[model samples]
Target: MNKALPMSGVRDSTYIPENILSVPPNLSMEAAMKETEEVIFGAIVSVLAKTKVECSEIGILIVNCTLFDPIPSLTSNEGIV
Candidate 1:
């Protein structure tokens, strides 16, 4: 809370703990993979809910990530198509 400290520049709209400006020391490959699965599955479900498209109706799936390409691939991890 001291003005002498550099923390005064922090933005009111920004959350320091939740933001990913710097990776946490405990971050690991397993955690990254779990997050990837959650993201992929959540997005697929969101699209299906909006479009009213059945899961079986989906013929092909494509995945694109900035810096993540797991061993089995992203879509394959979903397993439900």
Candidate 2:
């Protein structure tokens, strides 16, 4: 959270996992997936709203995530472009 660090200009309101802030941080796959979904969905909604683009207008979507690739994938799970 140090502003002096590179790429540390993240907003104060950014969503951070509770476990990450805990005294002894624990890794939670569930928490990570939830955060990922929130971030990706939020970005999609924001872009669509800003561009005034309809969901149906989107022909293809390429989601690239290295860490947590689900079996159904986000696109398949949501059924949304």
Candidate 3:
């Protein structure tokens, strides 16, 4: 028997500093990228554990982040899934 599982999450205001509310929109792109990666990875891991999907069973992984691109690759996500 086979099953399909879908998981998703959202993390708003990733680059917004904790102390500054009225600051300009010049948030750190690097921080936002890292935060996005972390959130996605966490969500995928949670889904896998809850669904009991083996790592080898995963065939595809996709991430959507257009605001921050120059940070780095999401290779770390492989470890999470």
Candidate 4:
């Protein structure tokens, strides 16, 4: 069975320019969630392409995040499944 594994990567704050502080923090949680989902899905697609796995063949997907826990849910896998 094919599997999709979602892994985490680190972003360096040093890459941000000094003038970035001028930007407003008008970020919505929904926007953040959509961006994150797109990123994760892209990563999964890349891995699947490299491994010759079909989308329909996927049996499971595993994701791990340190922050942003779901309310009343110990693990996020429940939402994915």
**How far is each candidate from the true structure, as Cα RMSD in Å?**
6.7, 4.4, 12.0, 11.5
State the C-alpha lDDT per candidate. 0.65, 0.71, 0.58, 0.53
lDDT of 3 at 20: 34
Error of 4 at 79 (Å): 9.9
Which is the winner by TM-score between candidate 3 and candidate 4?
Answer: 4
Worst 10 residues of 2 by lDDT: 72-81
**lDDT tens readout by residue for model 1, 1-81:** 566445666666743322244465435666666666667788988999999999888788888876567767766664433
As for model 3, its CA RMSD to the true structure in angstroms is 12.0
Quality of model 2 by C-alpha lDDT? 0.71
Which residue pairs in model 4 clash with each other? none
Write the residue-wise lDDT of candidate 4 on 1-81 in tens digits: 123222333244333222333367435545445445665677888998899989899776666544434454333434333
* Clash number for each model: 0, 0, 0, 0
What TM-score does prediction 1 earn? 0.58
| Global CA lDDT computed for model 4 | 0.53
lDDT of 2 at 3: 50
Clashing pairs in 1: none
Q: Candidate 3, residues 1-81: lDDT per residue as tens digits?
A: 123222233245345443234355445755555566677777888999999999899888777655445435555544333
> What ranking emerges by lDDT with the best candidate at the front?
2, 1, 3, 4
